[model samples]
Target: MKEIYLIRICGKCKKTNILINEEVEDTIKKGYYISCSHCGSKRIFKENETSDLRKCMDNNVYKRVKGKIRQVHSI
Candidate 1:
């Protein structure tokens, strides 16, 4: 199975891409929106939205997962 991360932008703050695991996928699919911890913006991103914010996570970032990340290596 392919792992997926949900990406979203804060409506009020318009910053930060919030990523959630499979556990929250049900709530999202049901039309519930997420709130920003900083600005309390209630927003929801679609399932297919793509963002580079995941690559910038300092703590959870990784170099390679079998093969090197294509875009990061290209740069």
Candidate 2:
């Protein structure tokens, strides 16, 4: 399986901000803050504020599993 990453979308620039799982955890424990790299907007260091990279990429209409490719549709 491919490694998944955490991401936060910038509200102002609509840019994706990637985050390390370990770093996020540590930051939450220490009450540190995070910001958007593109627009310099402050971000909350909460799990609910971020999303999994896989979930973000689910908008793709196609997917590949093993050696085969298939179509995907969103409701």
Candidate 3:
């Protein structure tokens, strides 16, 4: 099976991270990512025994779509 991932979305500007993290359901729902991609809100994502490395979209684009895939990373 393909690896699933989770993401964080900004509440203010609706900015989201381009880099998807291999996170769990609760973790993503609780809100991940250390900060916002656009407005740069200081979000404190609790840490565990996971790596802290991530990649982000430079233009801060919002990927809009409406579809369903067989493998999905719930958030």
Best candidate, TM-score: 2
Candidate 1: minimum summed lDDT over ten consecutive residues — where?
A: 66-75
Better of 2 and 3 by lDDT: 2
Clashes of 1: 0
- Candidate 1 per-residue lDDT, tens place, 1-75, comes to 544555555565555454655646676698986677667766644433333556444323236657854222211
TM-scores, all candidates, are: 0.43, 0.49, 0.32
lDDT tens digits, residue span 13-35, model 3: 55444334544445558876356
Worst 10 residues of 3 by lDDT: 46-55
Q: Which of candidates 1 and 2 is the stronger one according to lDDT?
A: 2
Tens digit of lDDT per residue, candidate 2, span 18-69?
A: 6776676678699977778767988433322334545655544557888775
What candidate 2 gets wrong by more than 4 Å, as runs, is 1-4, 43-75
Q: lDDT of each model, Cα atoms only?
A: 0.51, 0.59, 0.43
The alpha-carbon lDDT assigned to residue 14 of candidate 1 equals 51
